[model samples]
Target: MYDFLIIGQGVAGSLLAWELAKAGKSVFVIDKGNPYSTSNVASGIVNPITGKRFVKSWLMDEIQPFSLKCYREIEHDLNVNFLSELSVYHVLNSVQEINDWSAKAATFHYEKYLSTSEIHYLDKEKVRNPNGCFEINGALKISASNFLSAIKNWLEAKYCYSEEVFEEAALNESRDFVEYKNVRAEKAIFATGYDEFFLKKHSNVKFSPVKGEGLVVEISDFFSENIVQGNVMISPTMAKGIYYVGSTYEWNFRDELPTESRKSELIERLKDTINCNFKVLEHVAGIRPASADRRPILGFFPNSRIGIFNGMGTKGFSLSPYFAKHFCDSLVAGKALLPEVDLKRFF
Candidate 1:
């Protein structure tokens, strides 16, 4: 019998599997091959600076280093370049905004990341911006597809992955073990994304889903080496001549299908930022499994023979590695968990 059986192959599942397997624990992953899952479409932009005030990221100091070490080690093991060190230019929208950024740069601990030099990539003549741009440090762009692909290959090499959908009927749970199909494991973990239809079974934990929509635009004239941010962000993808521009956060609607109104909204915003001819390559949408509080939902089920490691939310790429290790240590070595992120948040 294996040590654990994991449901879903998104970032949460992938990272937990990596941590458990690397620790010599037997693990298996089951997924439905849903390309539209949130993990695949995520721009994987892990920024240490965000929002209107330009404050430091939530727990920036510890999370970034852990992510760097983990992704680098995984890169070596998988022989893939998935992480790129990149700076984001927080395009100040107005003179007042620029002044606010300048003041924040003076006292803000992350001042080293902010820059006043004019960006060379942007067209100075066409864009309608009187105020200059300021750059910030502490941003890393991760390619979700690349990272997930590497994890899948590693798991498949051990014969621990299946592309079939997971049915609740297939799961047999006891006080200490879970049986599924031909495999029996001492424990089971659920790491599914916004598809938390099974979460009702463990009603103690609370998860709020947020719908996010992004657009892919192909432009010949607009060229930038750094992530551009103002109302929306334009992050570079590995695909040539293409960039992922997004996103809109909607709390009311949580559907995977792209809406025409959302698409139009994104296109109009894109036109306001870049003065260039471009084509709308694709429109993608997904629901994020954001918790009521910002921290992740990491703990065991309340009444049954199962566990869950989920709720990475918008910070999935940055938070997954650190917490995956934490959860695995708690399981394998009887380690204590931080009170803030512990599953007891709901209680």
Candidate 2:
């Protein structure tokens, strides 16, 4: 019998399983192996400051350190190289915007993450920066696709991973244990990303999923050492002269397929961001499981051994590692989760 039967090998499940397995708990992970899953295509840009007002991201002060440590540990454990410490530059539209950033930079709380900055690594001919861009310190650009693949390979080698769809109706649970097919476990965790079919089984929990589309482009003249937030983000991938640019967040999307209209739309925005020659290699789309409240959900359903550790949203790379440890440690110690992120909020 395994200690965990985790559904989905996305970041949420992958990190949680890592935490459990490292703590001497046996875990079995099942995934559909969809390359287009939201986790696979996400740019994995951990920006400390975002938006026009230049306000700090929620929980950046608390989660960044913990998550970084966890990711480095995962790198060592899995024998993979994917993490890269980098900066993020946000375009300030006017003198007022730059002043706002300058004011925020001098504050005590924002000192480490944001400093009075200037444009760097951008070409005057390539990018139209009239007011000059402010740099964001403590930003990260992780190769999430490579990281996810490596984690799965490690899990497969340990005989704890499978590429298959998990049928919710087949799950069997009693007072003391949960059983799925021939595998028995003390508990189960649903870390599936934006899975409507599976989430429908539990109507009590509410999930607000958002569809986003991005592009993989090869650019020769323009070079971005870090992620640049403009009309969209032009982030550096591991490969030379290749960048991941995107995305349009559609609150209501018909399906997860890439449409020609959106493709044309992204190309136009890409042109607006850079004044250089580029080739669009691929267009990708995925629906992310975001909560209406915009906070991650964690905890168990009442009167059941099954639990959930999902809703990391766009910040999964920075949120999952720390929260996964928090969830696992809480479970082992029989403690309660934070009221804000606790599942009872939706219940």
Q: Which candidate wins on lDDT?
A: 2
Worst 10 residues of 2 by lDDT: 115-124
lDDT of each: 0.82, 0.84
TM-score of each model, in listed order: 0.94, 0.96
Model 1: residue 43 alpha-carbon error in angstroms: 1.0
Q: Show where candidate 1 strays beyond 4 Å.
A: 115-121, 126-128
List candidate 2 stretches off by more than 4 Å.
117-121
lDDT of 1 by residue, 102-207 (tens): 6777764665566444432345553434464677776888888898888888889999998898988989988778999987999888888776577676566777
lDDT of 2 by residue, 1-347 (tens): 99899998888999999998888899999999988888998888777887678888888898887877888887898788888888887766677886888889889999888765544545668886666677888887779888899889989999988888888888999888999998899999899878888678876777788888899999877787888776778999999999999887788889988888888988898787778899999899888888778788898898888889988877878888878988988878766788888988987
